[model samples]
Target: MTILDKYILKRYLITFAVMIMLFVPIGIMANLAEQIGKMIDNEAPVNEILIYYGNFTIYIGSLLFPIFLFLSIIFFTSKLASNTEIVAILSSGVSFARFLRPYLIGASIIAVLMFLMAMFIVPKASAGFNEFKYKYLKRGREDRVTTNIFTQLNETDFIYVSSFNPARKSGNNFTFERFNKDNQLDFKISANMIRWIEKDSTYRLTSYQKRKLRGNREIMETKRRLDTVFNFKIDDLTPVSYVAETKDLFELNQFIEDQKKKGASNINAYKLVKYKRWALPVSAFILTIIAVAVSSIKRRGGMGVNLAFGIFVAFIFIFFDKVFGTLAEQAGFSPLLAVIIPNVFFGVLALYLLQNAKR
Candidate 1:
């Protein structure tokens, strides 16, 4: 690379580092302020508190990666424009496309780093961060499951529960049904109360009754208490809120497939997370282009004007992402499409800005 390339790339990376160093501590302090009461009330250890904040840093940083990157690019590029560095570089026989090369290279570096963090580091950190929050701050929150739960466990098996308490690993009004290949009801079990025994990996059913169908006859059995194994686990019945955020890419894909097999109601939420891992990286490129095109020209109000415009665009991008992601999770919109739409929209904006800046 030329001296110009190295100069621009160095500035790009340095500004991004400065942005993270500046914003992340502020984010941590804000989060700590909000949750400090809970931590003290729960009598959390010093070491555990430190660890929770450490994980929180990663979790929050990943969430705000795009905004940090956008602001960093705008900050540096606007300064360059204000100082006439961009004009000088362009006037020195450098084509606009050529001028963008080093910025794209720097963006590619950040994108890869962010992608790796999202795929590996962030998930582990998110798990710890959320675990600490729910354990200490939101006590008894994880124990609550949706009432009147019904789900298909497999092609031939189904389960129902009137109420479930995940903390106690117990539920009431449980029913299990099995169907034959000919679509006939083979058997069914109903229990007044059911509890999972972790040590034995079995379910204990109280006031149990079973009925089996054969040809034109039915057999019935009753028991006060019964212990048996079934295809479903406690997690399959009561998924935690941050379950998707805790899984890395491979684990997340496998989880989605497993949920699909079980006909999980929250499968779309999991699928959204999977799609976003990829979308975030692609958005790095789009945001970078937009930041450059919007800030590379000198303006009357200098860097502030450019920075304000960059922030506006950043907020719009985030708004689109969140709105579409919610639609995907709650309204059955295509997860992939929901994740990609914002990127495509902003990508077109970037191209338009770049074309205008070229002229």
Candidate 2:
């Protein structure tokens, strides 16, 4: 549009880029330092290690995207304020709302990019990042799948296991049940041990017993070992940690729907991830407005004061987000509400600050 718009938008984008470049490497180095001992002890290969860090970079960058953008806005806007650039712009017949046009444009660009990354790119990177960590860094730790697993495979069928070993694709004390439309037990199967054969895609059941309930007559069958196909797969038996984080938006929505049908215990956690995919990008707009409003005024203590305030607000936003998210996951609070509440609260604050700054 105007020369003023170009000038401000360029500074905004440049500062945002610079902030990413600075924070991503620092995050990688700090994470590497913490995990280096584990890597060395595990004798991880060089290429794998490099790839892990590469994934880590994307993971951490997406995680901290809002904070970096917030700080970048504060830094440059504070500089513009201190150097009287904003004052000159305002005096030159540019209204405060008009002054914000370039910043909003810049924010829109970042928000769209962040949304794309969150919806598509970050999930793939998160999958690799977590896969490497669990495989190498967490070797010998407890299995990702918990013991005493129970799941409903579908409307009429269910399965249970006393304990499952994901590495071996086997379980002990397995039980499978099927029910009729009237919720009557149609058939029941029990096995002392069950193992999955990957090549054949069948289950090997040892010491298996089956009972058919046929109108007060029980038909019983027993076998020492039998191979049969079940409705469930290994993934149905053992869900990995971070499974929700690994899915893109479309896949995640389908996953939430599937989990809903199965009556999953951790559906709230999955819903939270889904809601946050949208919330994180929308927060970019709110944070940009707040940052410009807060730092556009020249302060007595210069950029340090504005920076401190910006960091404080950012931490508060993160704290509220985590607290509400945990409440939703554990305390049965609404996941959608948990994700939106923090944004609403801060968005109101942003509006308040913007109104005051405009005068």
Model 1: ten consecutive residues of lowest lDDT = 140-149
Stretches off by above 4 angstroms in model 1 are: 143-145, 152-156, 180-184, 197-207, 223-231
lDDT of 1 by residue, 1-359 (tens): 99999999999999998999999999988988998898899988899889999998899999998999999999999989988999999998999999999999998999999999999999999999988888898877683346777778878998888888877888889999999999889999999999999999999999999999988999999999999998888667758756888999899988788778776776788889988998888888999999999999998999899888988887898799889999997799999999888888888899999999999
Top candidate on lDDT is 2
Candidate 1, residue 353: the lDDT equals 97
What C-alpha lDDT do the candidate models reach, one value each? 0.89, 0.92
TM-score of 2: 0.91
Task: Note the clash tally of each candidate.
Answer: 0, 0
Clashing pairs in 1: none
**Candidate 2, residue 64: lDDT:** 93
Give the number of the best model, judged by TM-score. Answer: 1
Where does model 2 exceed 4 Å of error?
A: 142-148, 162-173, 181-183, 191-209, 221-229
Q: What is the lDDT of residue 314 in candidate 1?
A: 76
List CA RMSD, all candidates: 2.2, 2.4
